[model samples]
Target: MSASSSVAAGRGAPRQASGALWQALPFLGIFAAALILPMVSNDYWTLIATRAAIYWVLVSALNLVVGFAGQLAIGWVAMLTLGAYTTSVLVAGNVMPPVPVFPALGVAALVGGVFGFIVGLPALRLRTFYFAMTTLGFATIVTQVALAWQGVTGGGIGIVGPVLPAPFDTIFGFYLFCLGLAAFCTWISANAAHSRFGRSLVAIRDAEVAAESSGISKPRLLGAVFLFAGAMAGIAGGLFATLQSYISPEAFTFDLSVLFFIAILIGGRGSILGPFIATIVLTWLPEFAAPLVAWSTFLYAALLLAIVLLVPGGIAALLDFRSRRRIEADRTIVPRPELLPEILGGRKASEAITLKDIVLSFGGVRAVDGLDLTIEPGAVHGLIGPNGSGKTTTLNVICGFYRPETGSVTVDGEPLPAAAPQTRAASGIARTFQTPKLIGEASVLQNVMVGGAIRGRGSFVESLLALPRHRQDEAMLRHDALLALRCVGLGALADVRADRLQHSELRFLEIARALMLRPRFLLLDEPAAGLSAEEIRSLGGLIRAISRQGTGVLLVEHHADLIFEICDQVTVLNLGRELAAGTPAEIRAHPEVVSAYLGS
Candidate 1:
């Protein structure tokens, strides 16, 4: 069997298993050490270890936000503080009847989730430093409220923490309880990290436009993550209050927030094990050097700077020894067009994607003017024009990236909502960018899997818990992603980071990602821009093969020869309007096409 066939046959299963084992080793070692710590260390050490576990319960979930989603949520300590106060006040019976500790913690989680969603609302409209500032502001407000609410919070005097009943009341028992909870948090977060939702988060971070085209709703996904993270943080706060036996505004400081945020950065983004290790190390650092505790924030800042300058990928990069191995110097993309049928799976859409009298403008310039086009299933349609001729613009219109002033995009004669790019994937439209937008830090296979974000049947909760439906979603996506990779000739490099691939390889990678959608209409935007002549020929062949499998291909390219060789019908655009439309032979001889586009 061929290499691709071997891959499809699950010959790589052992390697995958081995890789998974390696990934699990560090986490296993850490948790095992925590499990056995009481036997090896004193009660003082137990307290410190317990503190680390409590902090991890929060950081693990926050890793999904700051690390995976790339949202700068620096004020997550606000959730922790809120959780602590709510748990303490409810149990103290200051305002209401006394509540049990576990029940109070549960209520704290619910409250945290609501506030977390509120804090994260600005993120939907804001970005980067702006969102970070909002979180910090919220943290400050929480502190002020805790200080001013003297009756329930006890103001500066603070409130008594809840005491657990029976076995969990002892320090050792409590340590074990926190450790177990931390491990559970780690397991769930890791499950999410490996699921479609996890890959979608990374896609949103690095390739948002592509993510949108693939049907990842940033608002929905981010909102869900914030709620989960906040709940976890709230749980951590309850545990932390019990550990200290007191709850106060002073305990949840900005320094604590810095420690949580820095732990993720120092460990790495998109890695559970790295941040887990970082959390333990940072928790123990202050105890190791007592004098450094006063300058904890400064230490975190300095460490983050060093990590940024020296190892940008953080501990995760250091641990990824596989990436250090050199890929072959002379590599070629030998796509298996025959495998198209298997990947496409005979799921053919009978209707075409049609745009009628589309008029889109930017300021005073009409980017696309009175444009009408149709991409029929089982065919290749070419859109060709010179610079600024609105070829890409027209593709964007169909994809819902841009709302046309006067036009309608229809799939099977049903009008699609305007400016809703996230809806395109469900409508059976998938596209590639002119410049490949990909998660550089992610594996090629994972990047391709991002295209199938909408295809997963599992919900976020299912993914987080590793439920049956989530596992099935993952298995199906993984098998199809590998198939798509093999189809595009990137199967061998499936484990490699996407940024490591060559420019030509990235183009094919994008196509492979697009194929994951099983799109009825696959739109290519200047796909042949930076490819070699040979690679372009291979691309043209692949495009034709995809069309033959019942996928309507709308190829916007500058390579005239490629268009003539493969496209069934060619549409030539000049100044946002169709200048000529015919078969390759007819367009090749037309006087207007010859003068305007082909040559004088």
Candidate 2:
């Protein structure tokens, strides 16, 4: 690494720490105000504040699901209902011997986590409105079950809430207890929101295919988040029951569920403080106008509509002044080939990525048929053909997005598992889409960081607690992502939102993201699609430089000049079959190749 690069890396540390602290300020201020509420407020206000605190405990975790992961879990109140009833019954000894208050709450949380996983299972196979309906249906069933199960849940008459012994028995004392738990919840969830797992969640929400290519398992990550969120909701329910001193099926209304979901939306997707503040505000709004309590759902809907119309990005967007700053109009992507060695230093793949007799068809029409190709390490191999010639399909097959009917894709001569895209990154394969698949709302730095998600050694628990291993993983990813951005001429816009970049810049941004993999085989699909002449020249040089650094380059492009210019070997495809394969010079002059693809 150059001294200048080291200085740049060093300079990023303090800035990142400072930025984190800056983000922390809002959360600190909110909790700090909650701490002092008892000193100035009366009993009624204190109770209201306590309710808000309890609600925040649930919202803090739900933010990870609805906000960060972008799952529409509208009926989360089911978790709350389950938690409330479970704690009430256990404390009342309705099903067995009486349990202590804390133990009852713990049991409730366990039940919630289990049920949460069950509720979230549908999300893996279902999408959007269908998933939302499933959650809503679950909430309905829980209510109906509570109403019918008279022996255990006390039916319509309801059950008494568990009261904590001493220090938390008094109204204000109980408020303090709830407030403390709320603060603790804030800390842990915030820790997760800033970790690699958090980034992967956002990536999964916004760019699932890209997330998968980066080795993010949607089922595993979503399952973990659902479990955590459900547990928190359960804890919140126990607290809510205690606050009310009674629990009933009527208490956990669908309207309440709407409020919880809306709070996250009003606060903004992928924001902790936004949802935190929204939770408090929404909880207090009904109390402020007593008549609004009856029409809470309507008011909530109105508020959400207003927020969407006035600020589509919600409270988070309003708070983000940094992104509103104007970016430079004149910017150029000057690829730094020297940095290639630093990023790709340890990546040494001995064998090529080979495809043997591959056959993939859709609706009996072959997309790739009887194909054989090898992407050799440290070489530029270009695949070119007319439209629907299976160039991109071949790339997809190699990336494991599509399974071939009869073939094998191997790395180091070991066959890659068919139909498993997430395993490709581990096999040292990384690729960019024909159209750039990126998390537009996230920063350029964050989007690039997504590509290195599999590189993190920390577990979800480690990230949730902000443990040493998680911190190390974060620092390593940040440094490497920065290095990637600098190499691809995107360092200046690291903090900028990806959607704000120009077409050409987005193209390079994809390359920057791909570099984060330190891939042994880098497959690019028409990377020169939207580039200017000079930009295309720079991209060609970067691709060639990456190939020279011991990474295999599979270039799928329509630009004949670029193919002939950067590629050492060229293969032309026509109707899912190879037309010609030779050195670029030989392919460029072949009579049949010129007539078929290069143009007469």
Model 1 TM-score relative to the real fold = 0.97
lDDT of each prediction vs. the true structure?
0.91, 0.91
- Per-model TM-score, in order, reads 0.97, 0.98
lDDT of 2 at 557: 95
By TM-score, who's the top model here?
2
Cα RMSD (Å) between model 1 and the true structure?
Answer: 1.8
lDDT tens readout by residue for model 1, 255-343: 99999999999889999988998999999999988987888888889999999999999988898787888888799999999888877
Off by over 4 Å in 1: 1-15
Model 1 worst lDDT window (10 residues) = 1-10
State in Å the error of residue 78, model 2. 0.4
Prediction-by-prediction clash tally: 0, 0
